[model samples]
Each structure stands twice: as C-alpha cells, then as structure tokens.
Target: MTVQDKLKQVAESLGVPFVFEDWTLANVEIDRTPLPAVVYVLPASGELDFKNGNIRDNQNGMLAFLDKVELNGNGQDNDSVVDRMKSLAMRFIVKLNETGYFELLGGVMKYQVAYNKLNAVTSGIVFDVTLKEVTGICERNL
Candidate 1:
C-alpha cells in the first residue's frame, strides 16, 4: 500500500476524518467537516537512491490535527483542545511506528500549534520518512 493509504488506515483506526494535502477551509463545504480531523501533507520534495540493488525513497511530511475553535461562543477550551490534539498526535505516532512501513529520521520531529482565520486550531508534527524496497536489479539488467 502507498503512504497515503497507510495514513488513511491510521486515521480510520483512530476514528477521525482523513484529509489529503488540501485541508483548507476556504470552501464552505469544508467548514462542515467534522472537527478533530487528521490532515496529511507531503510538503517537501523526496529523494530516491538506487544502491546495492535496492531503492531508498526518502521524503518529508507533516501530520496535523485540526479542530474547530470558538472564541466568544461556548465551546471547548483552547487548552483542552490543544492537549487533546497532542495526545492524539502521540497515539498516531505510536500507530505509525507499529506499521514499520516508514523509518522516521532522528531529531526532526517538531510539534507546532497554530490558529487559522477560520477559527480553527491545528497541531502538527513534521518529520522525515524513508521507505526502502529491494529491487531485482540483476534480473532487470539481464
């Protein structure tokens, strides 16, 4: 399965909506999406290395937890929302690790919290990922 497919599976296991790279709320329909959603984006370019009869695919991506926020209206507290997102992010990382499909690079994980103009808050983690697969170089060359 592909990286996006694996992420969708993780999102399904966590019982949250999964959005691709485009999670912008500019569209009115997007505003109606349920809160506490998972957004996955591959924001950086990737590299492919062919060595030792194997292909190494490395890329950088981000996983974001998004929720609707209320300023004056009665809603969940901002701190609580952020805390919940953090917890969810941790769980997500655990699940991703269990998959063993991606190798996470060390010292590149960054947790960020930001608010958008649509009164939505997001907590995200950025990391580098690598996927290696053995290629039958001899057979192909023959």
Candidate 2:
C-alpha cells in the first residue's frame, strides 16, 4: 500500500481520528488526555519517532502510588501498577504498528515517544506536545 494508506491504517487501528485528502495526504489530531496517553508519529527515512502526545500521570496525586508493584514491600503492589501501565503502552504501540502509515514507502521513516498535555478551555481544545521522543525507531532521518 502507499505511504498515506499505511498511516491511515495506524490511526484507525488505534481509534484515533484522522483526515486524508486525495486519499494520500493525512491529518491526524490527537487529544491530550490524562492517564498516560500518547500519540506518536514515525516518518520514513528517519531513525527516531516523534511523540507529539500527552501523558498525564494519574498516580501523581498520591505518593507510593507505584509501591504496589514492589512485590518485596509489604502491601506494595508495584507489579500490578507497573503491569497496567505497561499494558496501556503496549496497546498504544501495537495499534500504531497496525496503521498503514508504518507500511508506507520506507515505512515509518522516523519515530519517537514523547510526553505533553492539552490546554482544554471553554473556547476549544488545543494539544501541546511538550515532550518529543527522539529515540526508538522514529529517529532523525534515514
């Protein structure tokens, strides 16, 4: 499939919204959500990926939030906590791979996983991707 098609597939798989003109060009808008959410894009011919997304630390409100994952610690459930988070991350990455964009010519030229948030206001919702992932399969360039 063409590059655009590939990208579209990725968006659809992840339940993310996207618009494409001429059935080739694509426009994807990711909402800055809470709970470790993310929207990453990897261009072709690039070594890194761009994570123009958001990751709201749900556990930030409380301390020892991840203590649960620490099996050694009494009453600590770090395992479950970390597991759930890892699961979410896994799902996100899996969906992106299924997207047609990764299958584009040279496919996923670059990629990265970043962190950021959305400035939601009465006027409208604007997502500000603060942290951009410069490593991973999504790199600078081919």
Candidate 3:
C-alpha cells in the first residue's frame, strides 16, 4: 500500500472520518457537519533521499487535522479544548507508531489550535507530521 493508503487505513482504524488532499470548509458541508469532526490527511512538501541507484526513500510532511472542541452548555471551558486536542494527538501518535508502513521521522511536530471564525462551536487541531516511507523489500543481485 502507498503512504496515502496507509494513512487512510490508520484513520479508519481510529474510527475517525478521513479526507484526502481536499479538505475545506465547503467540503465540510458535504458531510453536513457543523463541526470539524473529520481527520484530514493532507500531503505537504517532501524530499526524496537518494540511496543506491535504484533505491530511494520518501520523507513527506503530512498534516493531520482533528477537532479541538470543548463547550459545555454554559460557556467556554478552561483548557477543555486543549485537553481534547492533546488526547487526539496522542491517539494519532500511537496509531502511527503501530503502523509499519509509516515511520515517524525525527522532527519538531508543530501543533496549533484554531477556532472556526465562521462558527464558534467549530474548533480544530492542526498537527504537522514528518513521516518516512519504509515499507518495501530491497533486493540486490549481481
């Protein structure tokens, strides 16, 4: 399976709705979702590490977008959204670690909490992931 396929599979295992490269507010309407409840695996910039003549590794930057929401009927709760975001992030990390196809490369993973300006109830967590594709057999024969 390709990297994208592995990502989608991971999201499926987590029971989180998965979207491909196209994930915009308009696209959210397709799901009739008032909140950002879907996980978007977007392909970002990447670099190809040249190995032997025919072998190379692809290191890619993928963005995982999750919901960061916490709103009791009363009002905005303190650190509730942040707590939820961390939980989701941890879950994602665990899932990625479990997958043999995608390897988490060493890099500073950036995270940001964003509020939906259009709708206050809709908040989101953006996670930047550095993944290395290492699922293949390398054969050398003279």
By TM-score, the best candidate is: 1
Provide the lowest-lDDT 10-residue window in model 2. 58-67
Q: Evaluate all candidate structures by whole-model CA lDDT and list the values in order.
A: 0.60, 0.29, 0.55
Per-residue lDDT value at 42 in model 3: 51
**Model 2 agreement with the true structure over 38-125: per-residue lDDT tens digits:** 2233332222233544221111010000101222433224334444544544554466444422321222322221111122210111
Residues 68-115, candidate 3, lDDT per residue (tens digit)? 345542235425555566676677677877776756543566777655
Q: How many backbone clashes does candidate 3 have?
A: 0
**Ten contiguous residues with the weakest lDDT in model 1:** 130-139
lDDT of 1 by residue, 5-65 (tens): 7778888899988776533442233365687777766546666666775555554566677
TM-score of each: 0.70, 0.27, 0.65
Mark the regions of model 3 whose C-alpha exceeds 4 Å error after superposition. Answer: 23-38, 50-59, 68-79, 105-108, 117-121, 136-142
The runs of at least 3 residues in candidate 1 whose Cα sits more than 4 Å from the true structure, single-residue gaps closed, are: 23-32, 73-76, 104-108, 117-142
Of the two candidates 2 and 3, the one with more favorable TM-score, higher being better, is 3
**lDDT minimum window of 10 residues, candidate 3:** 29-38
Evaluated against the true structure, the overall lDDT of model 2 is 0.29
